[model samples]
Target: MKSKGPPGGGLVYSTESGRMCPGCRQPVAACVCARQPARPAGDGVARVSRTTAGRGGKVVTLVRGLPLDDAALAALGKQLRTACGSGGTVRDGSIEIQGDHLERVMAWLQAQGHAVRRVGG
Candidate 1:
């Protein structure tokens, strides 16, 4: 078997320190670099759709393929949720708004200059 990191250049576990982060060579608990980068790049085009699968009897509006990164996506989700006066969240780089707000969400995204498309009827 071979070591995952560079030879003799990875984390060192000792009584002095509990754990370490190989990325920043810092303590694991306080390693800022270990956190994933927020607002990662994405593909172009944004699509809106409605689905009720696996969610009991509730319908959720799904918005996907937005070019914006995570921070922007979260902000946009917040705005859309507020606009719809409903609860929603961002999951797996997609915005999931509660209830069927496809028309409302499409209009809002189009107003925001997004190349929006209505998907899944």
Candidate 2:
């Protein structure tokens, strides 16, 4: 059987339903869809802390429990780095900014509607 083109000029194939599950956009069998309830703003608390575990005792502002995916986390990290005028990265579901900018980070997170707390010294 010949395949048909999708609505937007993409190719669509036969023998396939060409329909996607709204939740995951995957075929039904492979779909691991879950309805993500909307979390209230400022519900999750972002904790900031300092760590000196492997970087020559340099202080880092660690932001955790952001409830963001990897890509969003990366973007947030970039924004925080820019705001703090420092370098940072997102790893292990947390954002790590160079230096001890806990207060600044907390303020920023609060501005973004996230409850924040300082965890460690």
Candidate 3:
């Protein structure tokens, strides 16, 4: 499918401004895109669950339904990993901690005043 271009179909880069924002055609550093609020990915409640479906019987605790932006999500994921003393990564708006820490995660999130729910067996 043919995609629409930016307003006026302006240049995406300039020697004077470096890279431009495709949405605004302004220099990335001054683009209004950065100031816009991200659309929430889920309900306000955060869900904690454990799954061993992908790995070879390895367990990972998945936290989903957070309404935070990438930066805040990364920070929250880091704190959760540290509190659980495990390593993990945040991807696709979900936090994947490297072990089964559902209880720990739920408790910690509750302590942090987040509305948390458990999912899966």
Candidate 4:
């Protein structure tokens, strides 16, 4: 009796009993598919400032030079907002927290091992 083939007309086989490698299924641990560690980037600084725009001249904190990628910057912005207990957003590689949180945000960023600077009034 002829054995039934796989859906793509290929032979069906199981590697449940050491028939294949658990890492890359190449039957060897020295396979080129080994996992590599990610390189780390040094800590990045953030600049804080207060701006009056589109809000009847109300004060808003602007954070720039966070030196993080899009995803990392978003996460950092969320943390900063929570710490400041206010609303904020990440735009154009910068973070804008509502209200004037210059001192608060500066201290927080420094505590997180980031060098912060005050920019603008």
Candidate 5:
């Protein structure tokens, strides 16, 4: 059953474009509608915490509230991962480093002259 809205309502794929963005109706590679939102403003401090809520009880350190742009944040996340000798990713303006590296992250951030705060128990 389909309602009478309009013909060719949406284009999901194409031979030329390969894939189309629903929001912009442009090719996936050339789409400008799926831009990432700006990071939330913070108090100029980086908060680090360790949690195991998800990931099958595997501990992961989260660094939040860092006042940095996307590129800089990614670079910092990479450095943090290297410093902790583990793997991780940066997403939604936060850094998620695999394993529990609360102290190491805090120390590194402090050494880099960024105010660090330990969050959670």
Candidate 6:
């Protein structure tokens, strides 16, 4: 089939942007179909847990099922990290704070009016 042009340029690569989006023929940053993950309406509860499964012997506190949009979730993650005096990242709609600050996180979430449920011991 003859592919459309201009908006649907379908260029595999772009000189100006280095890499262009196939769907919108624009730079990835400006593309209409931004590669954001499908937003999940989580299972109706904010869950907190601690795990040391993958990080050698270091512990990390994980918070999942937050019902915030990307921007808000990132901002909330920053706030939580700051509050916990630790470092963290927001990934796949969840926050991972470095260290086992589960109690502190639950308190902070409750202060922020979220119904937090502790998942693991």
Best by TM-score: 5
Name the runs in model 4 displaced over 4 angstroms.
1-43
The regions of model 2 sitting more than 4 angstroms off are 1-43
The candidate with the higher TM-score, 3 or 6, is 6
- Predicted candidate 3 versus true structure: per-residue lDDT over 30-80, tens digit per residue: 999779565567888999999988789999999999999899999999999
Tell me the spans in candidate 6 whose CA falls farther than 4 Å from its real position: 1-37
Candidate order (TM-score): 5, 6, 1, 3, 2, 4
| lDDT digits (tens) for residues 5-73 of candidate 5 | 335578878998698887788988998887776668899899899999968999999999988888999
Which prediction has the highest lDDT against the true structure?
3
Model 6 TM-score, all chains together = 0.71
Candidate 6: worst-modelled 10 consecutive residues by lDDT: 3-12
Which pairs of residues clash in candidate 1, taking residues 3 or more apart in a chain or in different chains? Answer: 39-70
**Per-residue lDDT tens digits of candidate 4, residues 11-49?**
233464333434454544444566555333434657688
Q: Per-residue CA lDDT of candidate 6, range 6-117, in tens?
A: 4545576767777777776678778888766587878757899999998899999999998888899999999999999999899888999999899999999999999999
Q: How high is each candidate's TM-score?
A: 0.69, 0.63, 0.69, 0.61, 0.73, 0.71
Query: Which ranges of candidate 5 are over 4 A from the true structure?
Result: 1-36
- Tell me the TM-score of model 2: 0.63
TM-score-best of 1 and 2 = 1
Alpha-carbon deviation at 34 in model 6, angstroms: 5.7
lDDT of 2 at 53: 87
Model 2 lDDT per residue over 56-102, tens place: 98988888877777788899899999999999888778899999888
Model 5, CA-based lDDT = 0.90
Weakest ten-residue segment in model 1 by summed lDDT: 34-43
